[model samples]
Target chain A: MMSRGEPSIRLESVNHWFGAGETRIQAIFDASLSIERGSLTILRGPSGSGKTTLLTLMGSLRKVQEGSIRLLGQELRGASQRSQEALRRRLGFIFQAHNLHESLTARQNTLMGLQVHGPGGDAARQNAAVIHILEVLGLGARIDYLPEKLSGGQKQRVAIARALVSNPEIVFADEPTAALDKDAGLHVVRMLKALGRTRGTSTVIVTHDTRIIELADRIITVEDGRLLPG
Target chain B: MTLLLHLLLRRTPIGWLQLMHNRMRLVAAVAGIAFANLLVFVQLGVVASMNSVIYLTYTPFRTDIMISAPSPQLFGGALLSRRIIYMALADPGVADATALHLGSMEWKRPGGMSKVLIVYGMAPEAGAFAGDTITDQQLAMLALPNRVLLDSEFKDVGKDGSDMAIKQLSPETPLEFEINGHAVSAVGSFKLGSGFGYDGALFMSDQTFQRLIPERTSGTLSHVLVQLKPGADPALAVRRLNERLKSEHVQVRTAAQMIADDVNYMNTEAPMGIIFGIGVFIGIFVGLVIVYQVLATDVAAHMKEYATFKAMGYPHRFLLGIVFEEALIIAFLGFMPGVLLGSGVYQVMAMATDLPLGMTPGRALTVLAGTFVACALSGSLATLRLRRAEPAELF
Candidate 1:
């Protein structure tokens, strides 16, 4: 069981490689970091700087090759597939290109965030929760529209709604605001910050977008596959 | 259905939604499946009609028992000697026995066009076989030399050449035709339709048949038609006749057994039957390929979304469920149109060729079950690509 005092994510001497033998390339090098609850940390890096790799390692999307990654006080190194899957449900992920299913409507895609936990009680309540979160994301009018019918920013907002509707303990965003305009981007960050303060949810965002930098509680920079001092 | 759809929508129909996302692709997939189903149905229908023709040809000769050489098909192997008929009559349970000669001969139409006719020869003393259109008077007419009875219901529309149009001859029209270089006149006509092997049939006396087919000796017979005493059980009569004929290389069968043996021969040994069976398998292969293509494309297009699902903690089983659901939907949707079109084709073919060809409920159900299994198989094969769906790749 995790205590309230434990940081949401802790990494120690984490190293990751991309390939094997002649083609092998080290993606992340001797990285160590801790992200506390209720804190919004931003990972800023140039292209191929391993910030996204670090984010994936912390989010349990990638296997730990050499060092330890403790997510919500559960060790992810050499974790079983079932255990990794269980740990994934505690976290939310937003990709760079709003990867919403083209066939699903906005509301239905948002519902997928909760539905993955497997058929919980009260579908009506789940639907209400989905709708409420979409409304908060300023997508209430487009709830029944497919991804093709929505604009770029609207699609990204739908992706965000899908990520946050489950109220996950940790949210990992990769350029979540790349497709959004200034106001929409600010609205999304503010929503994440509000969730952090109210529910003690931690957020780790990887982006080159300069607008939301000041709003982050701590900004970690990555250069040449290594993390610099905050 | 509305209730089912409502429940499905409430559960977030990811699989259904993904299939419906691309209407054109869905249509192509369904069309492919429907085409495969149509191929199977038509092939099955043709084979079934061939079987029914076998039964219809033998319907007129239905009797208490039939004695012939041990051959898989009727009139297929060696000819039986009339000695078997006398041996069968020796049974106390047997009433009498008649030697029936059967052969196929080419009829030269007026325009030098040729048509094949199945010829039957029996002793004029033997009255018309049961269920046959031939009456005692018709049998008497066959006693006259160089005289034959034609099948009035023969339809020669699709039998090779249009010049051989002797469509629906009447007894009033005593058509003159030559069979095997022997001049024979149709004194009257019978009501037997064409079967799968022959374009028409003719009935005549044994002497006239011997005259037309000179190679067949006087004692040569195709089958010995047996009649049982009214009070005798058919099984006992057959057993007794078998015992009486045990010395000879011949077998005795009831009318039902005769039909079953002929039908089984047509299904298993005949080249056409084997070809049609292979056609059914080819249709299934075509369906599998089509469904695999559609599903592989769908999986490829949505690889990233699926990886996202995996990252969201959804198990591989959930993804498999979605794909298999799509395959099931395709199977059902395609089956309806295929069946409708197949029934239409059966009707057209039945009219074009006077054969008992149509869809039975059992056949329809079998195809439906086949379609489901095929699509399910395709679903599993397509999901082999899903094993490569790594959540880490989506990053």
Candidate 2:
């Protein structure tokens, strides 16, 4: 059992690769780090520098290939698919593309984040939660609009609302504000930072955005799949 | 079951939303499936009607056993000796026997066009033969020379729009036709549907039959219909009759067996039967292809959303449920229009061919079940590509 004060994510000698045989290419090399509870950590790297790979591995979106990763005090190496799914339910993900289902409205898409939790509460309460989160993300007016009908920034905000509605222990984001304007981008990062402070929710973000980097409490940089000294 | 319901309530809305998102594609998919179903329904209807019509031709007789020439070809091809009837009557189990004379002759219609028709000849007392179809009064009229009963449901117009042989002549209307140079007048009408064998039919007394075709020998008969005594086993009588008439070269069959034989021939031995079966196969094949294409394209368009779901910890079964839900919806929606269209086609076919073609509840249910299975199969096939959607690949 892990206490609430423990680190949300701990990594030791994590390594990852793509392809096989002669075509094999290493994406992450001997990476080790710990992300504290209620803290915002930013991973900074250029294109193809393996920052996204490290985030996915920590998020349980990809299998740990040659190292140990302990997320929420559960070892991910050699974990069953069912266990991984259970672990994933305690976490949230936000992508650069704002990958919302095009046919679903903003409110419906946000509700998806809570679906994996099962039908625990009444329908009204669930709906209210989704509405509250969307309103906080500056998308209360566009809650009924589809992804195609909303502006790029609005879609990103809806995505952010979806990630936070679950109140996950940790949020793994990859360039979440890439499509947003500077103001909207900063607003999203600030909201995430505030959640970390008030709700004790930890966040790990992969991005080249300097503005977002400045807001992070901890900054880790990667170069050519290798982690550098902070 | 409760668990299933919960999962369905959670997952099906996404599937429904995805399908309804593109109205044009959804309409196109439903239309394609409906057309395929229509093809299958129409073909199966014709095949079923073919079987029923053959039984209709014989249902009126009410005989327990039928005797005909060896390997008799459907009406009027072979002639049996009259002695076969006498031999069958010798059996203690047999109660009555009647000989029927059947022939096909060219008749000169009122318009002076010649058309081939089936002519049946029996004793006037044989009026009791077709209890419901022919009345005792109609049988007494057949005793009069040159009087005949015409089939009322025969097709009068041919595919070329020219009158083949008969017109829509009624019983009260003065009707005269020349069969083998002998003049016969229509006195009444009966209902017996047409099939692949013949279009129109005429019933007359044996005296008129002999007069119309003088070449038919007096000692020969077309068939012998036998009725068994109460409590007599038809199978036993057939066996004894077959033994007694071994030298006569006649075949013995029960009424039910004879009907089944005719239907079997039309279904298996006839070209039309095979064509209808092939048509059904092609319809199923086309349905499968159309559904597969629709589902595969839907999966392809939504691959990114699927990966996102997987990343959110949804199992593969949940993703599959979405595809299956879409398939089931398409199946039920498409089948309704298909049945309506098929009923219209059946009406047109019955009008043109004068055959008893229509939809039955049994057939309707069968087609609906087939549509469900076809769509389910398509959904299963489409899920093969869904396996490639991985959260790792998406990012």
Candidate 3:
């Protein structure tokens, strides 16, 4: 963690669990990391290594139990759910399932990310920005199509476009290319790194896909909820 | 919540759009509305039809005033004197007045003593009051030595179902009644009741009533039913007549006043009011519950979407507006089918049962207005859950 005006992503000795008492599964155990702005970090791990859990914790989806996790310099545990969602306006998210609201078109889905956080922006400008993002992300023609209408590669690209449309300060992606073929997977990886670099966003991608290891700036491996040496 | 609405609506008018997506839920919701409305229309129409039919039957009487002695069944107060009747007619503005002699008597039947029957006496052609159906044949029978006009529904009165076919007097002209040994011709047969509505009614001349009533020689009457000239102000005439007849122990009023007095008499110390009161309360309760059930289910199904909006920072008021919009839609669409179907229900009741009934647009509107308020209030019960549910809890 060399250069930091504010660490876009930070976690300190965080722990989390599901259920209570007799039936609890500790998903994140003693995890800590700092993502500097504009750095590209890859969290590489095997199945059930708590990568998704850690990502969600940092994303403010799950409330942390024992320790503090902060995003964009704001403490996650102290903030209300609404405040956390507001912070998500500046935070992009990508999941393995590519969970797009099934009813909305790709263009509209991307616009939702922008609308959620920005209250009272000009409609015309928002439309133009969304169109611009779709075109830049190579989804210009497919923008009007629903998720089921798009190919796997195109869906992931639409997801990428949605993540970046808000111009979030940090992007957290959980295996964005896991469902794509090799060529499309490589394209997704290259896009994540390039988009982050272009916007000066801290991008942390959780991936088990080994084909695009060369595309990451630095890869950190995790096993059994503990961070392994890079 | 406006901001959240702006976000959700900005996504699509997915509220309506979503209905297009799930045709089944849409159909179910609409069906729920239809069923709920059907119940409202049917029950309310039955009640309204009865009240309106009674009103129409009596509203056409040409009487300027009516007098009756106060009683539970008596709406305008019942049984007044012949002296008061003559004095009211003597008032300068009062063009003409007549006494309506009404009382109940038992018509002896072969099997046993029959039920009590109502008897009314007034001029057959004079316009103060009229009777139900009394045909020329029935009138001849009444004029003859041994016959009286029987109820249209009472011919199979004592016979077992196997042998006796019900023969309704279904009379077209006047019939006759026998008191002691004298024959009294009935000019008409009213629908089993007076303006104070009883089971069966018989109309005859005052002379006939003298034979039927023990006090007939005393020259008293049930009360006076009156009529005014073409251009007379009824209210002014009533005041004068009341003053003129005060010495004779009487009161005077227009036909409308008489009806109001009747209604007041029925409502104020009458058991009939209890029946109407129970009916109204049950109507509100049944209507409120069904509407609330539908609205609550709709709210529950769509609550996640609302939560998503809340998560995005929409205010509570906008959400409330959205819920109320749904309620208004239900009130109108649901209520109209109910009214139409309710009319059908009332029609069946009128044709099949003895209830006095007629459905009017005014009554339909009144039910709709009441239903709108009930549904809106019930919808509020559903909306508060949406307004108060924490967005994070939904996820």
Best by DockQ: 1
lDDT of 1 by residue, B1-395 (tens): 42374376455667777877898999999999999999999999998888877876775454778998898677685898878877888888888888888898987664567778888888888883534677787777778898887777665523434333343333454566667988887777766676776777887889999999999999789998888887999888888778878888888898788889988988888888899989989999999999999999999899888899999999888889888888988899889999998999999997887777899999999999999999999999999999888887776
lDDT of 1: 0.85
How would you encode candidate 3's per-residue C-alpha lDDT over A1-230 as one tens digit per residue? 22357678778888877789999888677888888777778887888887777776777666778788878878888788667766766777775556565556788778866776645778888889999989986788988898879987777777777777877778888788777788877876676677667877888888877787888777878788887766
Worst 10 residues of 1 chain B by lDDT: B157-166
- Candidate 2 — which pairs collide? none
lDDT of 3 at B350: 61
Pick by DockQ: 1 or 2, better one: 1
Model 1 TM-score on chain A: 0.98
Interface quality of candidate 1 as DockQ = 0.62
lDDT accuracy of residue B305 in candidate 2: 93
Q: Between prediction 1 and prediction 2, which has the larger lDDT? A: 1
- Candidate 2: what lDDT? 0.83
Better by lDDT, candidate 3 or 2? 2
Instruction: State the lDDT of candidate 3 residue by residue for B245-296, as single tens digits.
Output: 6665555556776566555554444565546555666666766776677667
Instruction: Let me know the DockQ for model 3.
Output: 0.13
Candidate 2: which docking quality band?
A: medium
Cα interface RMSD of each candidate: 1.4, 1.7, 4.5
Q: What share of the true interface contacts does each candidate keep?
A: 0.78, 0.61, 0.07
